[model samples]
Target: MNLAMKISDHDVLLVIDVQNDFCTGGALAVPGGEKVVPAVNRIAQKFANVVLTQDWHPEDHVSFAPNHPGKQPFQTIELDYGIQVLWPTHCVKGTAGAEFHRDLDIARANLVVRKGFRRGIDSYSALFENDKRTPTGLLGYLRERELKTVFVTGLALDFCVRFSAEDARKAGFEVAVIEDACRGIDLGGTVAATHQSFRDLGISVVGLEAFL
Candidate 1:
């Protein structure tokens, strides 16, 4: 690992949804999600400013099947919140699946951002919830601490990490995504296309070791 790079205390290292919900044996497991743990841990050890995001949702969250009528998991539904993607019932508040992955070193974390608590909206991104409407106070927290550059890495690069990186860019922060420290759910070529989209948006997509 590259311990030679100059890192500031203000540079925030954001770990998004590194929970069991997107890990192996979870209801909403992202393919290859478990693989990022070690890389993420190495990054955590190298960064002093570490923030972890959690998907803390209620059982009847509108994004879940039990709340949406005639909608099943993986289905798309248009609601007042905008394009909502229904997901499996996972990450219920205080549930074991909502906890951070066992392979992750949670001890190194400094801040915790808990999102997706509202029943009416689904929050795939740690920065903004559905439709870019709900601010998860992540920007404010980062701004208060004078953190302008954010390196985000977590489960499902095609979704959560992608969306979060976009919002981070929109929020006027420099964003970098450690591609190796993330997994994607694309059985098709969408993951590759999404990577290009991120490139188009000027989001730095690099391997975890690139920071070293």
Candidate 2:
């Protein structure tokens, strides 16, 4: 379907984890990660409602590969919530790498939500932690502001952005993911599968042109 939709106050541009660590020269850099900032900045200017999310993890967070002996980044382990991917220490709380990319236009965002602070849990979605039930209060914030439709963008499309979009859709909000504004880790050839899953879930995976 063509998504030539116009922007409104009720439609939010949700920028997810476009942080220093996800960009070039950082520990967990995604391919073409830096390119997302300019696209997001341009897209954000056209929206009255905008929110940004950060992956703010603790030093000993369960998601970090260093936390588990003999584990390497991208290695999978069985946790209580099922499979969890161990990652190189990236977005630790209060660290420079945890901050948003310097070139990103954060001023356009009305609200910023930080997640993954819990030492025992890893959070990827802005709306919920990895468990899929732990609330990050993003849904309530949008509800209070009377915003419903969410256009998602930003770092690591297969992980954070994808999970956030899915959660927003499950929460009953109209959701679309801006493809050009996103970069994915694409671990284990998951990029194509991720887009398929997005379609299966009824989430519109569109380009920046949709809003133009």
Candidate 3:
């Protein structure tokens, strides 16, 4: 809503899993997922610090539906942290689906943090794996850089983007989600729930105009 907000070096942009597997025609594609690329790329040019997180998983990663035998994608199962939705076999390490979207601008990124690589765990938050305490080292990197605020964007707003925003806020950084620069899978009103959760958590859900 703050159209005139000035972006500074302390305000870092976190691009969450804008990879081939989440884009248009991907194995786990979110509807309109590819639409966020241009806005994210455009916003990236304005940030002094840009960090990109990729959903890099191994072939037998625990989140995969194939590993669960009878389960299917989007089916909820209990994990140690809580219930986790089983996902399709995608973003396997060294696979084309694991790669960032072809049109995404990665040149401006200061750091590229790869997550969900460990075979036993699934990582939705860029800062922390699903275990919650296990860090991906992003917090330390941001702290070392003296960054204070995080502007988040990229694929599947209800999942990775939501988790990243919540974790960023919990890590003591002011957080904002660039709404227009994100798309959601939106299973069962998840997008609306995410918006309400963001409001409850005091995370700003702003339009692209907030930066432009």
Candidate 4:
């Protein structure tokens, strides 16, 4: 992609879930996830308005399978909030695996939104924790600062990245997800299914070139 284009101040760059837990050999590694580093870094450098989102959970966070008495990882359990899928313990607070991937150029970021810190709920979107408008303060900050659009790029295209983009759209911002700068766990099935889900909601999944 050409770097000649300029990114306006109203346009923000959303770095979604690039923590070590979602990268190679971590708690929830996505195949070839590490390969996205270069692309993410390059795209990040081109944007002046960048915000990063991290999955920060506790050791006993409800999302972890170990917290459930009889449930195991990858098992599905129903909660009052609806169906919650059990995930392996990952991105626990202050753990090495919870840190952002080493390859990312975080120094270029402006704000880092840490989510999923509550023991009873898990957060996949920067707009809210568990989709309930329990403020992550991201939307409010962006709105206060007058940021109108955000381009998302990071790990787990089907999960965190997807949810972030969807939430961005819901927050009344123009949303775009950089496909090549993301990697997915595919726990929800085919890549097409995930891409369709984003497209269904009007989120355009494209290369970083769009922003460039």
Give RMSD (Å) of candidate 1 vs. truth. Answer: 2.3
Clashes in predicted model 1: 0
| C-alpha lDDT of residue 186 in model 3 | 90
- Tens-place lDDT digits, model 1, residues 108-186: 8888989999988888888888768779998888889898788888977888888888898888887888888988987
> Candidate 4, clashing residue pairs?
none
lDDT of 3 by residue, 94-175 (tens): 9999999999999999899999999988999999999898999999999998999999999889999999999999889999
lDDT agreement with native, every candidate: 0.84, 0.90, 0.92, 0.84
Worst 10 residues of 4 by lDDT: 1-10
Off by over 4 Å in 1: 1-5, 187-189
- For residues 51-137, what per-residue lDDT tens digits would candidate 4 score against the true structure? 999999989898899888888998988876777889999999899999988878899999999999988888988888884658899
Q: Which whole-number lDDT from 0 to 100 does residue 12 have in model 4?
A: 89
All candidates: TM-score: 0.92, 0.97, 0.97, 0.93
C-alpha lDDT of residue 34 in model 4: 78
Q: Which parts of model 2 have CA positions greater than 4 angstroms off?
A: none
Stretches of candidate 4 exceeding 4 Å from the true structure: 1-6, 188-190
